[model samples]
Target: FVNRNAFGHFGLSQDDFERGMNGFDMIAPEDRPRAIENSIRVMRGEKLGLNEYLALKRDGSTFPVIMHSTAKYLDGKPVGIRGIVIDITETKKLEAQLRQAHKMEAVGTLAGGIAHDFNNLLQAVQGYAELLLLKGREGDVGYRELQEISRAAKRGGELTRQLLMFSRKMESTLQPVDLNRVVEELRMLLERTIPKMIEIELRLTGNLHAVSADISQIEQVLMNLAVNARDAMPDGGKLTIETRNAIADEEVRRSQPELTPGNYVALAVADTGQGMDKTTLEHVFDPFFTTKEVGKGTGLGLAMVYGIVKNHRGYITCVSKPGEGTRFEIYLPAIAGTQATPPVDARETELRGGSETVLLVDDDDSVRALGAELLQMFGYSVISANDGESALQVYGETRGGIDLVILDLIMPGIGGTQCLERLLEMDPRVRVVVASGYSIGGQIERVAEIGARAFIHKPYDVDEMLMTVRGVLDQE
Candidate 1:
């Protein structure tokens, strides 16, 4: 005789349980033998406390449960076994989420370190290539080859940027953005990229709120999702991109603990194609985790998407069933009382150089050599230092004569931040340009706040570096 609670636990009606259904039948088929053996042992006087197993439900789905049992005795003889089964599905889900979070953290650290080193190497290759191109005419023997080398280095730099994005080490320029506009801009590209057989639909709210985000990163997110959807629908299906305004109230917070109650802009991508299983869904956002066969995919697409959303102070979720298709929803906080702004196009300007004495500091040997050469070739008197301590010494000797200080943030002793503080103390009017292989993030922002004259990202573009130097020197 099953209790009403037990019947409810398995999603069973009282009449169904009364039709000769037993406890063993409620346990999953694969776990039945072991469960039966454990029960027999309990009845035969073995004190097995609590065991975990998968409990089968009325619709053939299964959930994790923990069972505790003791042998029932009457007149010194065992009559039956009494037990309790408690569902632990939610507990198991929480545990899995925690483990995934830890794994992502560890991987992110490793990715950030690798990107830093890679950027330094690429800077050397690209910098020298640009220098060579400047000296040779277009038809000169190896001019085209040098151009190709520079382009290749740029592609390598882009890969590192993606790595930095996934590791959450890259900086973003956040602005008020409308999801509907983003979708519209990419509509033609998406249509051309995705197969002709697949149908595309856009369901945009007439008055969706604006989100504070990086427009380029949002475009990347949308493109990645679209490509993923196309791959899932090899036989052709419908892909829907939807944008809507939403509110994360108390009820919503119960499901997503990471979100605070506020207005949000929701962008959802849904596909009618083959879907993912529970196991695949769990690791979908993990770096280098891929379902595609070797050489078909890089596996960083979803991982980068995950990082971009998180970096923007947003959240994302995925839902899918084996053959029922998939859906991805991204929620970014709404910027109330704001309108989406179009990005301004930067006008092309002629690269110019100035006759100013510049002090260049970098620990990397190749980078230091290349930077000193580049600056001198551009008509600036260059002074070089391998570390922050040496940089301070050089600056002290040159004192007022040095017109600009190009300082590298990461150094062996007296790192960038400390060195910057010391330099400020020495001369409040000192002009310094902070340069690094890393993107403009927290540390860079802090340096700017502390009176950094300008900032430049490494793997230096000759024109950009020259332009930045010229721009800063032109300032009072």
Candidate 2:
């Protein structure tokens, strides 16, 4: 006689059980044998405690459950089995989420380290190549080869930047941004790049709320999703990009525990294409995980997107099913009573040369040589040091002669921050420019607060570096 609660657990009515259905029938086919074995053991007075298995419901769906049973006897002979079933589907989900979080943390650490080291090496290669190019005419022997070397290094630097972004090591300049405007501006570019067969559609909502985000990073996210969608629909399909404002209240929080109660700007990219199955969706955001051919994809696209969203304190969810298409939704916190700022032009005008004395500090020998050579070539008197201690010593001896200090942020001894503070202590009026292979982020902000005159990112562009140096020296 199944109890009312048991009937509910099995998704059945009393009448159905009255027709002779039994608990054993609810055990999934693959686990039926183990269920029978456990039951027999319990009936024989073997205290096996609680046993776990997949329980099947009437609708052909399955859920994890733990069964606790004891033998029911009549006159000292076992007559039946009595048990309680407890559903554990939510528990399983929580476990999976915890595992994924831990895995991502480990991968992020590794990625950040690799990007830092790689950027330093690229700096040496690219800097020397640029310096070589400056010495020869456009069509001179080895000029083209030097250009190729420079271009390749630039490409390598871009990849490292992606890695840094994915690892949340890169700095983002956040400001109020309108998602609608971003999508509209990208529409023509998407049309030009995506296959002609695929139709593009925008469903932007009017008067959408503004979100505080890095415009460039947001653009990267959109481009990555659009590319993924284009790839998903090889036979041609409709790709829709939508933007709207949303409020995440109690109900929304219940479904997505990661989100706090607040207003948000929702941006979604959907494609009517071959979608992902459950297994594929599970690992979709993992770095180096891809469904495309080896030469066709790098698999870092979605991983970078995931990192960008998280870094912006946003949430992203992907929904898909085999042959049913896919949709990626990103929710960024809304900024009330603020207008979106237009993106500014970051192009440099000219390579300015300076005649002032500059002190260069870096731990990498190749990087140090390249920086010193570049500065000297550009008409700047250069004093070089291998680390922070040496930089401080050199600055102390020539504090009156030095016009500017170019300090590397990361080094073996007395890193950039400490060195900057020490320099300030020695002479409050000293001019210092902080440089790093890492992107601008918290460290940059800290140094800026501690009195860094300016910043230059590594795998340095000759023009940017020189302009920064000259600008800092010329500043009153």
For each candidate, give its TM-score against the true structure: 0.90, 0.93
TM-score computed on alpha carbons, candidate 2? 0.93
Where is model 2 more than 4 Å wrong at Cα?
1-9, 44-50, 70-79, 439-441
Give the local distance difference test score of model 2.
Answer: 0.89
Give the poorly placed runs of model 1, Cα more than 4 Å off: 13-20, 40-49, 75-78, 188-198, 231-236, 250-255, 273-280, 290-297, 321-325, 439-441
Worst 10 residues of 1 by lDDT: 436-445
Stretch of 10 with least lDDT, candidate 2? 436-445
> Candidate 2: lDDT of 31?
97
Compose the digit string of candidate 2's lDDT tens values, residues 317-423: 89999999999999999998899998788876677887899889888889989998998898989989999999999999987899899999988888999999999
Error (Å) of candidate 1 at residue 374 is 1.1
